[model samples]
Target: MTKEQIIFLHIPKTAGTTLREIVYAQYAVDRITPIYRDERFMDMETFSQLPPEKKDAADIFIGHFAYGFHQHLSGNRPYKYATMLRHPIARGLSLYNHLKNLQFAGSEISFSELLKNKGSQFRNNQSRYIAGWGTQKMLETAIQNIEKDFLFVGITERFNESLLLASHDLGWQLKPYKRRNVTSTMWATNYADQLRNDKESMQELQKLNTIDMQLYEYANKRFSQQIASHFPNAVEKLLHFENRLHQAA
Candidate 1:
């Protein structure tokens, strides 16, 4: 068994729910250490105080926390970190729609207004989560951290490819599983479609997430390089993986 436990830093709306299910298949229920709710963050104080036995037994710790969670772990077990990134604008829109669905205090406001609102917490969220800061310049820090500390930084747009690469690299047996915590409603769909044509909204969205956009593009570049280095037969292997899923169906 792989001794390196995974500390998954799950950014919001980055296909993280689907990735969690895939990781779940590789470990027994007892091996997972759930840290926080969807909107809440991982509590480092509580995590560091986990009982020795429970801490020692954990093989994976998944949560919607910022990076540096590995430092909070209690045991001596070696660990690795992983995270996912998405197209910053798409992720930002998805997050907005989700909050709107929940009737967030300002749900009635326009998307542009939400971006302009200084209180909005979702802007440049992918970079913030990875770098553990909300500054515009932390984009380079996020990329440095990923390349230095993370086992892999997966991209949501290329989720299947990411999964297959991890499976091949780590000997993980990824059985077919359902996507969880999906966010598709008619209003959400309609708004997303209309938002594409609204140049002003789109421009504001891009401007607010400049750091996140750059971070995402860098991840895409690295993902392609990773595929070339680690799985040159990637296309054929991906097709075979899909064939198995169809056969199972």
Candidate 2:
């Protein structure tokens, strides 16, 4: 093994936990899972928060925050950076249902109310971290800040394909597919009744989820170009993985 490490920048509700599990299994390396108790750093503005010795120790760092790995990247430390994203509408709905579960258990706000005021109460992962509210600023930020050398940027809609691309990059033959965030899926299905019953609520949800709708549209359009840039043989690799799975079945 060449001993190069991969940094997985996990975006919330994007099947990231499942991806991390697969990566951990395939690579046989400890994965960085974000829990406040774990010693992994979350502070993005401060470099010193992540101790140099700790940075040198890990073969893979996977978490729900952004740090450019300056020490590793600038110094030829043999690190590859990758991130994953979900369609905005799907991600927003996932967040809503998650919070709505709390409402059911006796939070003051109703699911309908939350949908109406989504811009304030709910933070899209981008809004929560990188940019502010549902503004064009997010698009601008993404365009400006995106790495030209992102090893792989996984799209949640085509997750299996994304994994094959990442596996190929890591020189692994394993395939990752179908596993999803169980909690998120359950919450959505559980709350489907609320959505079905309230027409006004659904309309509010559409307004609140405008950012996600836009995100899905934008990502779907740009995905092909993104794949071509890094994974020249990505289509063939995905087809190969599909064939293997079918043969196994």
lDDT for 153 (candidate 1): 82
Alpha-carbon error at 194 in model 1, in Å? 3.1
Model 1 misplaced stretches (Cα beyond 4 Å): 38-45, 105-107, 116-120, 134-136, 185-189
Tens digits of per-residue lDDT, candidate 1, 107-185, equal 5677766656533456687888888755456888898888787887888888778887677555577576666766655
TM-score of each: 0.87, 0.69
Clashes of each: 0, 1
- lDDT (CA) per prediction: 0.76, 0.58
Candidate 2 error regions (>4 Å): 1-5, 30-50, 67-80, 102-108, 112-121, 127-136, 147-149, 168-172, 176-180, 184-189, 196-199, 209-215, 226-240, 243-249
